[model samples]
Target: MKRLSLLLAGALLLQLQASEPSVFGAGNLDSDSPYGLTESEKKIVENRQNLKNTKRKSQENSAQLQSLRERIDGLQTIIEGLAEKTQENKLKVTELTSGEDIGAQRDAKIAALEEAVRADEANIASLKSLLESMATQVDAINANYVSKDEFNALVGEINAFKRDLGKTLKSVSAPAAGASLESKSSKELAAEAKASYNKLYFKDAIPMYEELIRRNYKPAYAHFMIGEMWHYRKEWSKALSYFKESAARSSKTSFMPTLMLHSAECMMHTGDSANAKKFLRSLIAKYPASGEAAEAERLLNTL
Candidate 1:
């Protein structure tokens, strides 16, 4: 019975030693037993663990790489949009520059057109003035051929020139309100003198004419008309004095020959016979075909 109990104890110890090799490494087991576990089982377990670790690491790296790629794509999209916007701005600037050039050209053309128009207006005005002057000369020449028609035409041209000159004078003159009272009065007297002469009332014309002469307002016609009035009045000496004054005042007036004839007559009537003959001879020499010349010849024959 003792031997059996010892055997059972020994058997239990052997079982404990075999299980210890699995709990600890082969070094803790009996040195005589070289293998700790089956080689194929160890290799299969290590390969499985290595495969699991490799799969976990691959998953983590793939997630990180996906995030970086998404960021790079987003940056690329932003850069592309910036490039497109810059191109659009460049086009707009180009269009604005082109528009400015067009505007400058248009302004230059407008200024040139305005200058051309003004030059044409001045040229047209000069041409019209030349035409009117030529027509006046032609009408004067035609007067000898077609008396009444040509005379009327000439008068019409003279009236037109007077009207144009009056308008020009008004434009050139100082403002009427600023004119002196004396100037205004002289103009009125001259107008009245002209009206009286136009009515053939030479007596009524005299006082106004004298007033204009006193004012020194274009006194040539005033002196000539006064001399004519005195001659008609048969005041020989007075007529001669006024006629001499008229002749001295104006050389080109229609009154010159008439005044000379009257002076000669006055000299003859006043008994200055030698002086009258000399004056008559001068009149005939100066005005060969004039009415004064005829009168002088008649008077000389009588002498």
Candidate 2:
């Protein structure tokens, strides 16, 4: 029984030794960086080189991921503020000593605010899931390594403040019905729209801009122009909605500084001071040399 046990132990030891993790790979190589290598050793060396390359790439990915995390943190902060405001709405509801109509209006407003908060939270969750998938895209979801294409795409999505003015937007929509705009070339419509806008005939300019948006001719600028008209009208909600669409498309336009300023004002009027401050600060940081940045700095102090 003792001799049988000894033989079993020797076999177990050999099996354990065979399963050890190393690049040397079933070889008699003395060290990892040996002087001369066989074909198998050469293969191992190549693998090591590839791993070194992956590590370098991993470092770069880590930097991008860090930036992503900071942005996520900022978003989470905004969400928290929204949540706090929603709670305050409940208190306001309880303290409503006003008429039923007033109470109903307050309730409706609170409900809208709550719904917007829910949508924002859902968006944040989706973004987090996308990042997780991005991390897992390569070979068993290795956190350390990400493909360059995936990384670049994720960066583009997360880095909202990034400007790419030269990028042509290809987002075409069904044309809004307009005989004159429909007949006119895109260039002609753009020229006419700008002239009307400059003349402060914003009401006249709007349909032309909407036509441009539908035609996919500078849709971002079109959206911004429509938002600007709304801003002039002091219709904050409608302006904000279009501003968001404009930013979603192309945030790199020459008019972007004004868009940021107006967006910040819209948020402020809507009782979203935290987000308004964020927008103002981002504008100041990104367009520091611009006149809009000068305005943003003054606005930031007031915030």
Candidate 3:
């Protein structure tokens, strides 16, 4: 029984050795060999799992590369926009610098104009001062040449001479102390009229002469005196009327020739040329030997 057990143990040991795994060849199972097929099947399952992991990793890398390309395009657009903004800023800075230069030139021109105006004002002020000084000197010279007191004294002497000449023209005598002019005789009234006329008081003499005429005195002489007074007063129309009346009243008197010449002169002054010529002709024919006749002849030739 012991020997039979030893032969069975040896057979079992040989079978165990043949079933052990081998590494030198591809794992295949064979009935001739004692190894099992389980190791080869497990290797096939692991190869399938590795193939699935490699395909998933390739897909993830493709998605990451597409996203990186999109980010690069966005960065390029931002850089272009920044470049355009930088160019615009450069142009604005140039315009500001040019404006500053023009403003400086304008300021200088304004300052120069203000200086010129101030100089003109100073010159004008000097001219005005010089003109005032010249006017003062001229006034001083005029005052020295003709003083106010000397001019007034000269005027007074001339007035006195005129008064004396007027008084001399009247040759009337003085009136009696007890007699009033209104109650006096015709001769006294005539004398009073003559005295007033000699003093060049025509306004006073005219009324006294009129009174003599109312009393029927020597009215021709009174008319002559009134005519002379009217001539001196430049009343040519009034003087002509009185002269005509005196000549008509006293045709043979010594004053007729002179009266006729005076009438002609008054006619000429009054713009009555036809009447003046008639009077001048009458004077030349009636008083040929008188001095007034020669004067009348000369005046007629002018007419």
Candidate 4:
């Protein structure tokens, strides 16, 4: 038992010597034990180092994800701003196009109106020329045929016929209350006569005007118009007679200055220079600011 005990103690001392390092800073005493650790302890240290590397990698991945999210948010905001700007551009384009269309329409309307005004002016000029031609043709026709005495007789017969018609119309259609039959008839006759004269229907116009004169209504103007017709025919003696009568009855009318001028021209045509000069001087004295006064001054100088 003492020898067995001694063998066990020797085994224990060898184990302790193998576990401890030398005090001279030498390596492990036992060559079979690497780094003086057991196999299980080395395995545990390798597992702990592996866990730390995995944690560091995970933290880096998280930071990268946060940066990507911020970049995506900035890009989205930029896209939204671009969309708003595009809409504003579309509205501006629409307004400009609408204004251009309205201006084009307005210009077209103005052009059409101007064209119509030009057409109306042309039509009025054509009518005036046609009227003047008709007047000349009537004067030529009258001078070619119809003696003065026969024409006068025809006018008298027409006047008689008109008087008979007037009486019949008065009986057929009575005048309304407060209406003057005679005045209305005279006005109607005057309008018809003037219209006939304007249309160059002298044969129809003369008798109607004469009838009005016979009724003692607006006789001065009728006489003056008759004198104008005779003057157009170069009947100097008849023109002078009518002109004198017009002047006599034109005291309350606006036709006196014109009638006086006509009378002066008639006297000159009849080779009465002395009377022409005296009449022209009288016109100048009475109506110095009139167009007739200017003509009289020129004629008197020539005489």
Q: Against the hidden true structure, what lDDT does model 1 obtain?
A: 0.59
At residue 101, candidate 2 shows an lDDT of: 57
Q: Candidate 4 residues 1-303, lDDT tens each?
A: 999999999999999988886544433323444354556756755666676675455434334433432332233233333434444444444555556556766666555555554554454345434433433443443344323343443333333332332232232223332234245588888887775454333444667777778887888888887786566456788889878887778766676777778788889999998998889998899889886787798788888
Model 1 lDDT per residue over 1-303, tens place: 999999999999999987665545543223444346567655755676787675555444434333433332233233333434444444554555557556766666555555554554454455446535544554444443323442343345334433443233222222333233345577787786665453333544677787778878878778877776666556778878877777778878765777777787888888888988888898889889885787689789998
- Which pairs of residues have clashing backbones in candidate 3? none
TM-score of each: 0.38, 0.41, 0.40, 0.39
Q: In model 1, what lDDT does residue 64 have?
A: 39
Question: Each prediction's Cα lDDT score?
Answer: 0.59, 0.67, 0.60, 0.59
The candidate scoring highest on TM-score is 2
TM-score head-to-head 2 vs 3, winner: 2
Please, what are the lDDT tens digits per residue for candidate 2 over residues 14-65? 8887776544444545466554567988787778888778757765665656
Q: After superposition, how far is residue 60 of candidate 2 from its true place, in Å?
A: 49
Q: Please identify model 2 stretches exceeding 4 Å from their true place.
A: 1-177
Clashes of each: 0, 1, 0, 0
Clashes of 1: 0
Query: Candidate 3: deviation at residue 189, Å?
Result: 1.8
Stretches of candidate 3 off by over 4 Å are 1-180
Candidate with the greatest lDDT versus the true structure:
2
